[model samples]
Target: MVKDLHGKNIIITGASGGIGEKMARLCAERGANLALVARRTDKLAAMKEELEQRYSIDIYTFSLDVSNMEKVEEVFPLILERFKVIDVLVNNAGYGIFTYAHDADMKEVKSMFDVNVLGLIACTQQVLPKMLATKSGHIINIASQAGKIATPKSSTYSATKHAVLGYSNSLRMEVASQGVYITTVNPGPIETNFFDIADKEGTYVKNVQRYMLKPEYVARKVVDVMLTPTREVNLPRWMNLGSKVFAIAPRLFEWAGRGVFNKK
Candidate 1:
């Protein structure tokens, strides 16, 4: 049965554009109140205005760089205070710059870890106590298929996602008996501005453009699972199949898919 999101308070991070923005719209359409967080206040303001005009639900916008632990600590409590309770928290603020392992810069590596892994953890920590106390809440972490099936030129990005998957898995088990739920979204490449930074040379996108999932498609899949006990979501079911095979036979999969993996 499809769960009703009406009146639920959902917090979506990195909601200025891409799947995050799309998820915000989907949630709003279903009568879900929204808290949109991103570094782009202007875009968030525009979205807030439009969604408020279209939906009867309340909307809040926060200018946050999750990597900044201080800001994360300050902003999250303010959100909780405004909404009184957070029904769902989507940890989606993340970026990647594909570079060969040897060519990877230390600064970029630290930034990626800080934003993609530590930032996500810090935000989750802030809301977890409340969620556990209330015995109700959902935490969605946006990971990547690269976390499962590592490819060339994305070592650091893949590592960050791997950490997310690991963390989410552990947290899910820890909170299974409680009413709180944890879901990790491991999507393949999607049609979004994400590639503008991850693939500056345009090689990866050019190679995989035909197979990229649409932003709307991914967002809808995510929104559909909201308030449910779904364990994990993997986009492009076919790509997920490949990940399964790779898991069972790493050597064979890596050797056979080397060409596809090196597109970046």
Candidate 2:
């Protein structure tokens, strides 16, 4: 277990709001120095001021769209220049749009993959060489339970998460020989503005409102997991059990979970 986060330099993308924001606050409370990245400059600035006031550790803010590969490359160097070697990388920048595959906008589909998949890949590639050189590091990708249990109306979103899972799994093994640790967080629906757009109709959120995980709960779990590296983390154990069932018996799950799984 890693325990204390004091002075650990961590980089968290999508830190302006939602789960990313919650993770940033928690890490700061634990004494980790942070580089908060997001496109919302104003929000980032406000968050930085608040966090800096509460914690003595360094909190740097960067405003950039994670999908922009060039900007990520450029800003990341500056962050490293400021914070030195990044002890932890949190790939939490992602978005989703719920719609049937046939009716989905091609542009929206591409954006999801760009931010959720390629953006994550770009950031990881930028950090890996340094982590490998030091022989110590941790990478946490904020995936979704949608990745493990794909269903109707979220096919594209789920596809991107599946890609995250596949990449994280392979990368973890590849870097296992070194000291780098990779953890994929697969959380069920989280209470955030994400659903405002992800489910503009509000149908899914309404149906599963009771089961949605709190952002703080999810964030704390992610920060704690950094202490003890694990292959994967499926949040809110009850949801994880559903994912496990789907993994073990797909046909059975499909037959039994027709209504429940279709909630999303």
Candidate 3:
């Protein structure tokens, strides 16, 4: 049976667009009050106004760059002040720049880690204490299928997601006895603006356009599992099969799937 989200305080990072925006809408539809965080304040404000009008739930918008640690520290308290407690935290704020390791720019690489890995950790820490005290809360990290099956040209981005998976796995065990839950979302290529930076040449998107998952589909899958003890949510179950195959026989899988892996 599905859990109830009515009146729950859900915090979604990177809520301006893509799956984040879609998730926000779904949560609001379920009567969940929201705290939307993103760097795009204008888009967030517009969403806030629209959702408030459409749903009878309260909505708060916070302009945040998760990569900025000090700002993360400052903003989370403000969210708590408004909502009193966070029932769910969806750490969906991250980006990637696909490039061969040798050709990768250091600046871009550092920025990716700061936002995708450290930034996620920083945000999780802020709510953990309160969640533990309350013995109830959920932390959802948006990872990638690349974390499970590494591919060419996405070395750094994949590494960050791998870190996310590792961190979430360990954290889940630590909080198992408690009421807190940790969930990681691993999705294949989705039809979103993420490729605007990850694949500027459009080669990857063009290659996988036919198989791309829709944002609404991914968002709905995520929202359905909210407040549940779902360990992981993997989109496009077929891709997840490939990940399992890669894990069991890395050498053979890489040899046979070289062409598919290099699509990026």
- Candidate of highest lDDT: 3
lDDT of each: 0.94, 0.91, 0.95
Clashes of each: 0, 1, 0
Expressed as tens digits, the lDDT of each residue in 1-264 for candidate 2 is 646899999999999899999999999999999999999989999989999999999999998898999999999998888976879999999999999889999999999999999999999998889999999899999998989989899999999999999999999999999999999999989999999999998899999999888999989889988845687878889888988888999999989988886775
Lowest summed lDDT across 10 adjacent residues in model 1 is found at 1-10
lDDT of candidate 3 over 1-264, digit per residue (tens): 478999999999999999999999999999999999999999999999999999999999999999999999999999989987789999999999999999999999999999999999999998999999999999999999988988999999999999999999999999999999999999999999999999999999999999999999999999999999999999899999999998899999999998888887
By lDDT, rank the candidates, best first. Answer: 3, 1, 2
Q: What TM-score number comes out for model 1?
A: 0.99
lDDT of 1 at 148: 95
Q: Across residues 99-169, which tens digit of lDDT does each residue of candidate 1 receive? A: 99999999999999999999999999988999999999999999999899989999999999999999999
- Which stretches in model 1 have alpha-carbon errors above 4 Å? none
Better of 2 and 3 by TM-score: 3
In model 1, how large is the Cα lDDT of residue 46?
94
